[model samples]
Target: MKNNTYYRLTLLAVILSLSVTAATFGQGRQNRLTNSPREGYWVIESQPRQKSVALFYNDDNQLIYKEVLSKKRLNIKQAKTQESLKAVLEQALRQWAVSQKTGGNPIQNDQQWLAAELN
Candidate 1:
């Protein structure tokens, strides 16, 4: 019962957080990237003092990839712009490309994803 309650609360918190985030685009404070769309679909979740989490979802809404962007590379100031958002996504892929444990042909995966997104 206790575990179930905890799970419910956790789920509720996530739903609330997503709804609130979906409803707002306030700058420099949890800004959701806009004006840029791509294959599958990707979202940048940036928070102050927190390394932004990037989630890429397929057309069916299933998550495809998840990565954390570099703290030094996260440009919150320009994240709202289309070009900036693309750059941020590229940055995440570039970071992923170098990972040994990134699983499955990183270069091919990175190139394909980048081509799909940028082209």
Candidate 2:
């Protein structure tokens, strides 16, 4: 009975450790786009391959502000480290915001829309 209890405890510990390790490395060191929402600040809604859709809510979820962003014009690449990719995304966002103010449609230019992404 003592030996059986010891083995069971050991097995549980090993399984737990393995799960933790796997969870830690699950992203696999890629510079993937993470849409970590900034609560009570601002939110960007990305629409892929479309002009505009009639949204139901179309408003911030009780947050500060919200805006629609076409992914066809922002951070449309996967060839950089996470930090650099974040910088590029920020620049693209700024450009998109500007375009919105000037009443210039974003979906016009389809090839690498953001100037920052071209750099």
Candidate 3:
């Protein structure tokens, strides 16, 4: 009887350990877009009338981090390893700056203006 009880207890312990391990592993495998990465891009919502842009990069799974460039030239670099996204963001900013300098709005409502500037 004692040997049977011992065997049952061992089996229970093994099952419990496996359950715990499986739970932990499942949690670790969450969607990358939901869990912020140590490096990459993420998109966040902005306030109304706030001209903001977010550049994101993922490890083909989750967004690691982001670079948020605001309208007031607020350069906030949140990710460490998204150089390509950063370059594209900077290019967009440069284009906007040039449009402002040239007294032309890059994002105007007029279709002609947009087509000319984009082209």
Candidate 4:
């Protein structure tokens, strides 16, 4: 019973958070992204001193990929604009690519490494 209550509360928090986040963007045409219309529904959740989580869902509402952008993990700034958001996603993908090459060890959040990759 206690475990079930915990789960319910957690679920409620997520729903409420998502609702508030969605409301921030407004309705109808305002909700849609002009930069990447082909990508489908994308949800972004960001909070103070925590990792920014971006969830990309397909047209069928299936999650395609979820990226966690962390200052601690990648030293990246908060994604405030469309370009920055794309850069964060690209950084996450780049980390995945590097992991594939290096047998899955997590990469350090180094500015120098990121700068080299960008160049």
TM-score of each: 0.33, 0.34, 0.33, 0.35
Residue-level lDDT tens digits of model 1 in 46-101: 77775666565545675555655545234445534446446545555454446536
Predicted structure 4, TM vs. truth: 0.35
- Our model 2 lands, by Cα RMSD against the true structure, at 9.3
- Alpha-carbon local distance difference test for all models: 0.54, 0.42, 0.47, 0.56
Which candidate order results from sorting by lDDT in descending order?
A: 4, 1, 3, 2
User: Which candidate ranks first by TM-score, i.e. highest?
Assistant: 4
Where does candidate 2 clash, by residue pair?
none
lDDT of 3 by residue, 72-111 (tens): 2222453432443344434444454587689884532212
Off by over 4 Å in 2: 26-82, 104-119
State residue 113's C-alpha deviation in candidate 3, in Å.
26
Clashes (backbone N, CA, C under 3 Å), per candidate, total 0, 0, 5, 0
What's the CA error at residue 64 for candidate 3, in Å? 18
Tell how far residue 40 is off in model 2, in angstroms. Answer: 22
Model 1: residue 1 alpha-carbon error in angstroms: 88
Return the clash pairs for model 3, or none.
Answer: 32-62, 40-65, 41-56, 41-57, 41-65
RMSD of 1: 15.7
